[model samples]
Target chain A: MSARSWNLALGLVCVAFALLAVFVWIPHDVSSGVIVQERGQTNVGDAMAPTAWCYALGALGLLLVLTSWRSRPAAKSAVASGPRITAANVRFLALLIFMLVVSLVLMRYAGPVLVALLHALGANVTDYRSLRDAIPWKYLGFVIGGTTLVAGLLALIEGRIRTRQILLALIAVIVIALIVDLPFKHLPLPPNNEL
Target chain B: MTLSLYDYVSIGLQAVFTAHPAFHVLGVPISMAVVMLVAGLLTGLIVGAIPALSGPFAMAVALPILISTFGFSAAALLPTLAFLLGVMKAATLGGSVPAILFNTPGTPDAYLTTFDGYPMARNGQAGKALRVAQFACVSGDTMSDMVLITTAPFLAVFVERYMGFPEKGALIILSMAFIGAAVGASAIKGLISAVFGLFLASIGRGDDQTPRLTFGIPDLANGFSVTVAVVGVLILGEVYQAIEDLAHQHRSKTSPSPVVDRGDQKLHWHERLALMPIIGRSGLIGITVGALPGIGSTLAATLGYAIQKRRHKGAVPMGQGAPEGIAATEAASAAVSGANLIPVLSLGIPGNVAAVFILIAIDTIGGLNPGPSVFTLNQHELNPELVMVIGVFVIMMLGNAINWTLGSMLMRRLGVLQHIPPRIMMPLVLVITVAAIYLQEGKMTSIYFALGFGVIGYLMRKMQMSGLPFVIAYILADDLERLLRQGFSASGADPWFLFSSPLAVAFLLASVVVAFTMSRNPIGKTIIKNADPE
Candidate 1:
């Protein structure tokens, strides 16, 4: 995208946010007025600061739009092409988000799933939360989730995964889990606490 | 009934030295503070040598663990602050290692070091270059610390005596404006980032009974954790960008090769003496720039390098293997670490990212607030906060002493760390960051919040916005609101309280002027372009 278009897009987005904030969000969300009258005394209300900032943002956005519109694009080559969110960047962001979601799901449910699986296999087992503090049970979700997060990211970045990388990732996760868990027995790692 | 300054000094010294000994060395008992300081220094050296990791990242991860280890208590304050101060000081010095050895800057501020350092490495004078950096870094840091120690108390006292609520409010505004204007490429965007941060901060419970902007979410009522928001934006955001960069590089099949040490590695006494003038000038420049709220070490290093380059008459040109070049950049950047805290110690406003963490540590630990009140010397009694400040100074001195001795030697050997691929390190950092946050907050929601902010940070970076302004503004938002409310009430609910006093008016006017001027031609962009013409 050209510099002018980039500025234009930024300005429009800012203006849209400002409009929503001032007209919709603040009024609908905030319970107080810009100024309040209580027991014969006046005071600034919760909405005052946000409202003022919204106005300022709107003005700045308009200014940005005007400046970009007024400026000529003849010497575009001279101007530095600022940071752009390319298609590749978007794809990378999507992959990262997907990886994070999957890892988090595993972190939140891996232990419980394992416990249920054991129960199905004719083994006596209780709730995962009951055994969150127990050895191996506590480390399960964190290890699996943390390892997946690390190894998956490494694979994403390196464009390939090796067994050595997976092993290293597992070791890294276990070491970190131990470092947090050993000294501070009170501190629960990740999904253990949540469960 | 009143103790003298000497009495307070004695109290502070005793407090720092009389802590529970971690161990004894040759009949001498070393306090936990000292031990932590040494540990933090070593960790800082390693952290700073890594390409993508930085001092703030180390501080962010250490803070939660430190808080957990040393619970909220007066006794815990010194050791915790000491460890952080150690990390802050040593990281600046350590960052020069990669810049000098492999030409890849370990931190943004260290980029200037590459101008002269890489060339020195190519000339097989990498050892001498590292030595020059070490001496310059320690010397400049010591000088800045001296200035901070002497000036901070007096400045804090002055602010306490003279400044009222309106003045304080205006001062914060000025700081926010200055930071926004000076930090990023576009002043408007920087201001927008800061305001957005302020808006986000206003989401939680305010003066009113009802929580603002919560949208009725139970978690929103309590507000976003500062650590989660800041660490997410500063560290995770950088991690995300770095991951993308690595992926791109992998696809392109390009990788950086490591440089090996070859030649003269020692700095002679005469050579060290000869480089003193350049170091001194750069240190002064750094101190001046750092004392301000928004202008950071990048500009300091740039200005230092530019000024010295004009005056340089060495056989090798400034950008080419000149030891003076290395000295100038290293001294200036390292000096910024200490001087940057001047505003934090005196005015209760964080001047930079490191100062923000220091303030956060103080807040989390529940003692010794950084402001004019901390420096208020009571005639009838000894001020404990003042003593804590003194203790902090003592810890800084210890850090510098360590830097002068072991830090330089450790830094010379950190060349191997430069070879560690970012592809591996960044992912590990992401996991460590999440785990650290989880350990601290013990809430999965905090992790989610952090990742959410991390995405925001990544977007902000891609848009060329500096996260420093956003993070600083977020931290200061509560203080700003409190001051504004108090100032408004004190003026009988006058709407123009911020502009009521002469000092307040001056500050607001200056803020506006600065925003307008800097918006047109940002100082950061100018200096960066000048530093690297290509």
Candidate 2:
């Protein structure tokens, strides 16, 4: 697709979202009421500004679609139809998403230790090599294991831990523990007594 | 308007000599502000010479540290703000050093400087290019600061005295419309993005009285954390872009040609005289754009260059090697640094990420509120906010003076060729950003918000969206909503309350005219055209 088509598609999406926000997301009471008399309801019962902004966005999207469509036939091949999604881009994106999911899932449950491990490993993903090559594994397992141990011990000693090392370790632990706790469907949010 | 020239001078003297004895230090006798300015300038020179650590990025890293170290009250004091302002100026100056020597601009604004800067370097005038850049940048920035010293407080006082919530609301809307029309690919796209920002900001319940867009999520009851959103979207998104570039580089097989040249960096009096017009013209252009919400230094640099090129009539050969080109671009971009504060200090709208970070630091670390309140004079107790505001102007001049004296000397030591590998720096930056976010909010949910926003920011970057307007909208969303709501409440829910005041009416009308006119091609081609990406 040309840039115009892409813009049109984006415009359509904006229209849909804006319509939903204006009509569905805003509370019915605020929209219906003449005066919002509730405590701290400074608008006294006004929800129009948000709804007005949504309508304006909807209108803008419509205009964008019209303009882009009008320009579409003339929009021949150009140097910049925006960035293309190459295989490398896809791989980089996938790695990022994987890291994100892993970090989020592990952040609450395992906290510091696991998260650090993931980050340390995740750092290599930018190189577009194999996951192993992304990070430095040249030092072998003992080196990794020793550093991980010292990192964990330091976190344990500090009553209020906020280091990156602690962050990664906690993430790693939680992901592992959650896999083990699949049947129970329960997880502890870091520094907790639950196993 | 009310005060005499003597009263103003008296207040200025008092602000310097006796406002706070705590500021007194060293033999020079200015205060901690001098120390802060020197420290900030050195830090800026080092950081800004690195392509990855631009002024805004450095500010992002430093903000949490600044706040955490200084605490709220101490952070608001003259020294800390002065340091931040100093860093901002020096960073603008230092960006050109790398741009000249390595052809890798330290910041986006420096991208234009490389058009002539690199050519000059290739011509064996690397030191001269650096010197020209330093002089133009510092002088231009100093000029803008002087303008701010006059205009910001005047505007603030007017707003405090005459504008109510209704007028304020109208002004914010006007600002939004103007910024939206001025930036992005198109006015429609800009407006849509801004509205989207508002929608996103609508999420969360803050304090006790506001409505929450939580959608029944317990974790989101407190709203998305600003620290997370800012860090994730702005800083981490940049990291992702860098990583993406790395991925592409790994797939390609190419080698870079290294160029080496150095000389004595000194400026002749005649050269300085020759470059003054270009610097002055570009400075004016930069200050005009910077005082508004959306237009940034990149555009300013481009416009300045384009105009100066036209004026020169090809006498100096623009892209091949021209001192005028370097001067025009550097002066405009650097002028923007000081002028960017005009809106933030007066109207409370941050034009770009740097201003956003500054706003965040001021709000978090400084107990004082910005906007018209800073200019409000207490008839009873002599408002400290006003005193602080004036002191801030004084610190800014001191920062500019420091830049004039020490900036080029510091830039010489930055070693532009000794580029830090992204592989080494990117990971450290990521870790620092995450840790900074965690420290700022002290909540796990805040981390989630940051990560989530980071993803959004990354996607937006890939999609060719300008983050400036979105950030501006997001930052101003609460203020806009609050003002509108307050206006409605005060007017007993009257729908036309915005038209009640002449000021409000004027703002609304001006907004319509500006937005419509700016959206047109003829005007857009005239005003607010951004430079093409390198």
Candidate 3:
């Protein structure tokens, strides 16, 4: 278990999945109205003070993962034996816990062709044991023909109609969140002339 | 200071001799040698022979695989500037192969190549210090890509004729006084991490009206994403200190040895022309501290190995072995890898930290806005000389052909990176940095504001702070608050008209004598008292 108790249980499950996406899966907006004149009617994503600074940095990364899982140290004597682990560090820790469970389960149902099939499963986990003993059906045809040829060529260049690859990946994520929200558009200052 | 030096030297040499033509198949230049030099030299030898992967995680998985290979032609913008010049010369010679066999430091300019590359690999002269760090990283990155194609169009026509805006805000206050007196271990914690990275680059939402610090997170109204805050403060704050130093360390069972004395000793061409005058004084202090942003390439390879150990007064100085201390710290951090893309290719100024992800991939998929009119605009009308001559010959021949073919076969396959330990590589680089911050905003609230700036970049690198001058003053704080609110509405609010020109009164008198000598930190205790001279 130690590897700092699986990195303090994967940093306390990414601070309990960022405190259930800041208190029970996001959804706010009860007319901000200056966060209901200082914290009253709340809920506009809990009167968004950066969702309580993302639950105060996920409760300071859950108090540095419960003080690095209570200052580990306990196993100071036990596992004296050797060689038991290294099958290339358990295939690089099972390709780093299957790329953190395939980016917490395929980033909201396949966005970047499951992030380029997690970079072709990190180049088949750095030649997964020499392509699983050289061309064993080309490592199951590169994990079923390289993850269905990178999710059918990024769902046929994000189209072959699955609601046109989820409406062109949600209109390429609302035109890159409206060109990174163009300097947070307040605009009005000085140049106002009512046209 | 309206100098326009002949329209900044005829539009910076017609933006480096307008090159284009890369696409064509059956008839070569095959996508500029398979997507800019063989898939950027196999993503710079698997992110520079993986420590916990580097070269900004092969530019955050090659910028959404070149933003899903955006519409070809205009010579597929020279394979995204030849995959950022083969991940900046295979992450600077694959960060001196884990500072020569696992002392570790895959890149923070190979932390002074683990002080003389692990004492010349415990003196087995690790393949003659990895062939003298691949001939001083391909002769200091082909003499800093021929001085960034002949000195960045004469320093962009001398900063467009004697620069202004108080000498570009005293050259970002003397590049945050040489990144807070040359990086880390305190220059008042690197000017309080470049004033907390210019207050997180003046928190998003600003084009004007006013909301200065979006503490009211409207998904930081397009604020963050300086390539997701430089892949969340330099690769998700080094995967939260390699998952808290891989759960305070383990994996031992000894192996890394393979010393093979490459046919017994070689170097002497008069000991490699006496380390070319300390690799031309650390490639002129790595092209002037890599054209200064938040002074990068690990403080230009620790100020070019502290001016080649104070110009070698002789006696075996520079951390013991000295092949002119690995050719002045690998030719001054590979002469700021093509002079840190000459201010992100002529003034869309993202000076360092991989020119802030190649100025957010030439403003998100070369739509453009990298400054001095991305070599004079004309967007859909196209021809900005096809992305400034195939982004300068595919970033100087994909950074010297990935330093002459996989830079010495990824420095002799750096002992299969000690069987990838860091507890299965820090939760697989925090699950590919949460699928690159949800492919840059397919929001789970931008993965909850990138796990709230990955827990404020892991408590500002566990309080030692200095997240390289707060991620280069929060990626140039919204172009320094929209050029200080368009120089205070074109002058009316005249704070002495930001010091009436003369390059903004010599950048407000050298940023008030470098903010009064970096609020007296005395060059971080004289570079850790001459880097541990003990």
What proportion of the true contacts does each candidate reproduce?
A: 0.72, 0.26, 0.00
- Cα-based lDDT at residue B298, candidate 2: 86
Cα-based lDDT at residue B344, candidate 1? 88
Candidate 2 Cα RMSD after full superposition onto the native fold (Å):
9.4
**Best lDDT among the predictions, by candidate number:** 1
> What value does the lDDT take at residue B158 in candidate 3?
67
Residue A22's lDDT within candidate 2 is: 64
lDDT of candidate 2 at residue B346, scale 0 to 100: 88
Any runs in candidate 3 off by more than 4 Å, and if so which? A1-195, B1-48, B55-126, B129-131, B134-166, B169-228, B232-262, B266-273, B292-350, B354-413, B418-427, B432-474, B493-534
Q: Which stretches of candidate 2 lie over 4 Å from their true place?
A: A28-35, A38-43, A46-49, A74-76, A83-91, A103-195, B1-33, B74-79, B206-211, B250-265, B313-316, B376-380, B516-519, B526-528, B531-534
Tens digit of lDDT per residue, candidate 1, span A35-81? 88878888788998888778877887887788779977735564455
> In angstroms, how far off is B81's CA in candidate 1?
1.6
In candidate 2 the C-alpha lDDT for residue B332 amounts to: 91
> What DockQ values do the models have?
0.73, 0.15, 0.01
Q: Write the per-residue lDDT of candidate 3 for residues A58-172, one digit (tens) a residue.
A: 5545654665577645463432221023344445334433433343333333432433565687743442323323322222321322233223323422234354434433443
What is the Å distance of residue A115 in model 3 from its true position? 31
Clashes of 2: 23
DockQ of 3: 0.01
Which ten contiguous residues of candidate 1 chain B have the minimum total lDDT?
B525-534
